[model samples]
Target: MTQTTEFDWRPFLLRWSGEWSDWSDSRSDDETRSEGDEAARQGRWLGFPPASEERIVAMEKRLGRQMPPSYRQFLKVSDGWQHAGGFVWLLAGTTDARWHDNESGLADMFEEDLDEDAGPDERRDAEIWRRGLQLEVESDATYVLMDPEDVDDDGEWAVYTWAGWRAAPPERYANFAEFMRDMHREFHSLRAHRTEGEPEFANDTTRELDALVEKARLMALRGEWERAGRTLDEAKEYGRPRAVGLGDQIRRLLGQTYMVYFEDVVTDPRYAPELLPSLVAEHAAHSYRDDSTLMFHLRGAGDDVVSSAYATLERVRDGTYRYTAAGPFGEAVERARELARWGDTDGAWRTLMDALPLWQPLGPDHLAPMGWVADPLLGPLLTPDRGRELLSTPRGGQAGEAPARSAGLDADNLTWLADPDAHDNLTSYRFVLVEGVAPEDLPGRLADGDEAALDDPMTSDEARRRSLGGQREFSSYDDRALMSVGRAGDRWSFAFDGDPAHFDPRRFVSPAAAAAAAATAAGAGARAVVVWSGLRTWRGNPFFHLSVARDGAERYAFTYADAEIHRTGEIPRALDPDRFFGSGSGKVEGEGHAEAERSLLEAVTGEFGVHLPRHAITNGRLHTFTSRSWTRAPGNGETYAVISLNLVRE
Candidate 1:
């Protein structure tokens, strides 16, 4: 052969093998080997092939994109050496180049290279060597081939193209490009549908829920509580499960609505018979676990709701409904009071009895109304003995014992008695008299002063008057002197020196005045008053003193002197003088002082319902000047006095 240009084919071999390997792998192995054998036989195909250009045009047609020139050149080389393993030698100045193994090819080139120095052109070519086709060249060279009859088998060809060939661009183009286009189309279609379609799916359910709540609120704002409650019921149904925070929000709304409705329904008579029970039941169900909320409903429901609340309260008290002790107990007491007020006394009493165990532990405040069971129509149910018994029993360390005598005197009985006159018919009085005689007669003889001598059966009426008249100016027997008359109602009265200018004996000495005075005195000092009746005689003497003290200090004192005059005929005649005063002393004296005192004391204490101790009595003597003493103690105290007086009335 004529000497061929010494071509260093290493660079060309690398580029050609890399390209051919990729293209051949993209095809089936059978196709690649057949192409290689054909190329081997056709020596012209050993160099760059003319078929590469045709392949580029085919790929362009298949991809619908034009091929770059550089990419066409790269494909040409790839097609030429599709399976010619290493190197291809071209005949000098001719189109034929014989393929040879790389090692042999390089060795022969090195041997030839010793004789000829490398030229600039050769060095430049060496520097430009690239093993694999550039991305743009590969893109132009690639095509996804599928059997025309097996279009449905594109997935197999697509995977094969990605894995076998190193044609990443072709793989991405085939899968991702088509996928993104379909996604875009779908997105546009959805956008258009959203813009044009009726918005039925977006219902105003939330708005309906909100509107219901708002309507309820507006009703509340307008004070139309019943309407508000109806609206809230609607709201509860509307907001059941769908809305966020709906349960809690509706619960609160319903709570307020029901509370207002409960109050209005219970207080307004028109609604009490029908609406109250339903409201209470609904409230109980919703607020069962919440004692404070339950309490709100219980209290708001007022008297008409008592029966229902009583049932619920009984459950709460019985531990069926869990609640703080104070809440249920308070509600129970309130309900009981309501029942009692509405003439359901038995029901009220029974309810209270049921609640007592629970309330007792909660202490006095809870038991306040129960404690009032002793009032009027309710009082007959709570007898005095029962009251004392309840009061005496200890509940939660609170002693139910009777209050101190002083405080007890101030209790409601005496404070709220209806009839003041009825008091005198209730209690009795005992009058003790102390008399002073001449110093010589003090040891054994009772003094017979002018007033005293009037009682002697032998003394003439004239003698008694002259004696009383002679001693009257010198004696301390002025009408102004204070003297305990008798117990009347819850109070004790005494005669006091009235302001002479304002004193009208007719009024001051009147039974009405005396009754008023006694009540005033008792209330002023928180002391129960004791009255003395002159009709009650002690050793033929009608004289008595009444005394009251706290801590042994005298709060009040009164004395009644002169049995024949004051005791025999004082109150009855003072009350209605025209009826009995003209009668003789004997006729009046026959009205036993002891019986009157007994009756008066009983009437007063019974009417007022206060207990008075007998030791609080004090009797003083006339002329001898008996002294009574009192010591101040924190509670009720006793007073002592000597009463020595003799009365003889004409």
Candidate 2:
């Protein structure tokens, strides 16, 4: 609860009290044991529900803090409202007061790191935001909070929302009163908003016809979205220039319902049978005839769930699916349940399975949009001692635990991982793929037992200096890509920047990445390049990296997954060879190693074939990264580097 200084904010609740009570009466039967039994609560959203005096007192005592008088008075007037004051706040009720600091919701926004491009001022605000008490989840990208440090005995903490998209300091209100007043203004205008939105299909050319929508547009600019949307609806029609020019009104109305719909569809489980179909019906009007437009509106918007839903529904519309909705996630649960009631259990199960990839990145907590689909909703459900074990094995995505190194590759010289010599123990291994090169170029050559290729690798100056003088034809070789023959895992994870906690493992395997890289190399008319990284030691760090093509070589794009590495860097494009191996670079004590130039990641991509856009290459440092220290002594003290697998085109 937040205090109101000059004005009592409780009127906001009083004005909307009946609206909230109606919601509670409608949703009371929706509560179930299944939602709670899922190891965590599912779809916990904001709604105004009845609160008892006794329950409110207990909740206050439990939190060890008194509610701000304005908010406290609000609760007394009408328990707690889910989406109160037109802002997103699932203001907790008496029983829902416990804070889930560990929950993966907007609760994490308190500790969100500054954006990479965040300025000094924005960074300072994030540091300040860490101190605020999170009040509720405003949306996926934002949260409401009361800053305790800024308050005193009056319990008047300024309320603000932490929204990442907003470049300014998170918007703040003087108190709950101001916030409520602003919200009240919009609801009062709903009539005008909707009146202007009614279509005048016959008046195609007159500016007078568009006047109503123009008024609603001003409301939208002032953040009166719900009213603006209703007004936009009235203006909707195929020939209505007002709606067409302003936005696609049919879609705009559907978009407007998203937030309110999230609250209703998630909390009203008892009415779900009818509510779910009605929710889907809102989307039924839009026809997705072209893939490009679909991709633009869905993928380009970065909305995976909606994009997947549109794609899945398209398949159903085209006869590619029989009896399922594989999701935009939230709808899938309802669709699956409906299918089961109709005796399509297999379809229901498939629908649920399709959603696994969607939540995998959210980790094993596995939240559903409407909580858990009742396991025994009458179909033969698979019972297991552990609920999570009931789900199928998920493939590469930061969906589960960090995979331990492959025992086959991280061994004392196993033949399968290619190093038969019981020398330097393998600590880590990554299936390397330079964005625009074939796996046959480097990884392929090393696997072929061509030790001579690396032993007399082109000297630093030869490749860095001599190669720049002319269009030289370097020797090339290729073999069948055989690396996929073994039981190697097929995925690469991009943890948040380089932090492992937020790593999202995906299904892209190395061979596929290599093939992508190779295709790009071929298309660029670049010569094959391959080399071995050996002389391994426990004291030294080893990693696979590909260098970008030098200046004269059509700017060959290679790959390195991380944008930054520990204290080491790529060689400069035009620096002399000696300068690269100098102490400032990867040079070890009493040992020298060449460094390669760092290249911009933007100009290239995994255009090797996969259309994934987030993928980018950090310039390679292949030749310059081979320095190992022999000073360490613990295990069998032998340094090693040998081929694991290599296949190239003959």
Candidate 3:
């Protein structure tokens, strides 16, 4: 069909015969479907017997023309074929192949709808459909039509595939063989998502090609990217169905190209940290909203990786952060920048590409040399080649240390913690600070019993799981409530623990109340201050509550849950509520409730001398404990929402 005399159909048809199934249910009997099994046992192809030369001659006499060379050769190999991939059930033998009957009326419909403004391709497609030979004996709303008028120099007719339901025009191919190859590829693509029980090709050449594609895949995963690229290029030459996509993948990793389809992007875990953020940014430029495909995969690299990327994006957009290159890579980037500034963008791009191999991350969040995206001089000059090169090159390196931070509290340092949408978890924060206590002692003091221990301190993630009762709906009424404790100076801070998504809503209500009750019970005359500040609740409302416990007794409490306010004791003269939530307050224009929450936190911390260091609370290995007495019991008449439940009568 491709006008190539060297082409052979026997090998491909043999492979198809081995793997073919009547996926369309065109064959009604079990005996017909069992032919392949019997043939496999006998070590022979299952294709039907080839058409004799006399049959071909008679069909040509009836049609008044000779069949296309490739199609004619194909008939000599197999009279007919089953499961030519997609919706096609079988190609017709010489006995049934004839001029189209136009029973579907698609040709007449398209002809009547044709407009004078239609393009050349559209007009040609309509003409092909209106007067073509039908080759399919059976199919599901699929047409295999060949046009004699659209013949090649070697008298090979152009083939067209059309589905009645699809909105697009008919897909044209060079000839019958090209169309069959595409359908074979479609078969592979359709089953690509399934990772189990891969099909074995019967033919040696097909088997070899499939093996090459898989080998390239494994090589890419092992960071043998150059080798994988070469393998994929070779597999492509062999006409492997998956080779083109796999080659694109290797190209993406090598920074020679980029993929619009994010799911197809497979990152080497070693380079994911360096590549994912830039990958996300590249996708973001083309997309209107965030892409979950790359974002979810990017998050697998590390905990702070996604957040750090977001911070970088925000800073870049706001013009506050600029990437300053370091080392040989940085010097090359500088040269590129200088060249770009001089209006020699091509030179700048070439300079950047040349330095890609020398690229190393300056810091953990130094995603890439992304200056080009933001640089006015270089932004306009970026082509797919240059952009993908920046995205995927400098592919391998361990991240450097983060920059040092100042000791005292900086407003900017609190921004990420304050923003509700910034991180996936810990959006709702509640902390209790008790004076005159050690970090380890806070856990014991805040628990009903001595269940809280420091001998086996768990990581924050482990503590979160234990606090939620280890994937169960309920723990015993006396089960401990997990909390993290750390010291900031003379005061110890006890935080309500567990990631926000995992925390049971029934257990989260008024956390300050339970925490205060526990703290003051063991206070021994010490003062404890509790505050729960949420920029936005699960219901999308801002909430705040503050309470104080002194000398083993609760003294004061105040809450601002959306529009309502509740107070338990006389407000402290120092904490003037009017100052924070006066007229034209609560929700400010442009800046929502984050500003209010931040200001209130600052005021409360300053007034009560409550301090929780940003680093210690967020990153340090603080002591973890669970309160044995903090438990909840719903009334018999009360309704509850739960993922799972178990009742114990012990």
Question: Highest TM-score: which candidate?
Answer: 3
Runs off by more than 4 Å, candidate 3? 1-3, 19-46, 195-207, 210-246, 249-259, 266-268, 273-279, 290-327, 334-347, 353-380, 384-650
* Candidate 2: tens digits of C-alpha lDDT, residues 1-650: 43364455344454344433333333335565342222122333223445677777887788766666555655655554444444454554555544434343443453375567878555545544455555664444556665554555677656666556666566666555555544443333332233334532222222443676676554443334346556655454212334432333222222333422322122233323322322333343254444343333232133444444455445433323222223364466667655443223345546654554453212211122212321223122222211222222232132333222211112111122223232223222222223333222443422334321221112223333432354233211111221211111112111001100111112111222222333342355322211122212233443223332321232332222222222223444442233333333344322221112211111112122111101010111112111111112223644434333343688
* lDDT of candidate 3 at residue 293, scale 0 to 100: 55
Q: Decide which is better by TM-score, 2 or 3.
A: 3
Model 1 per-residue lDDT tens digits across residues 1-650: 11112223335445333433333344434553555445544442334534455666766575444433322343444433332211112111112111122212323433343435777434322221211111211122222221111112222111111122442321222221232222222222222233233332122333554566555543333334345445655444433221112222223222223333433324344333333333444454566656465555445345645665556445433323222224455576567554433223345445644454344322211112231321222332343433333333333333233322111111222212112332333222222111111222221111123322212111122222434454423211222221212122223222211011121111223222122222222244223333334333223445433433332133444334432223322232222221232233433344554444444444445533543221111111111211111112222453334334556999
Ordered from best to worst lDDT, the candidate numbers read 3, 2, 1
Report lDDT per candidate: 0.31, 0.35, 0.57
CA RMSD of all predictions: 41.1, 22.9, 17.4
Each candidate: how many clashes? 48, 32, 0
- Assess candidate 3 and give its TM-score to the true structure: 0.47
* Clashes in predicted model 3: 0
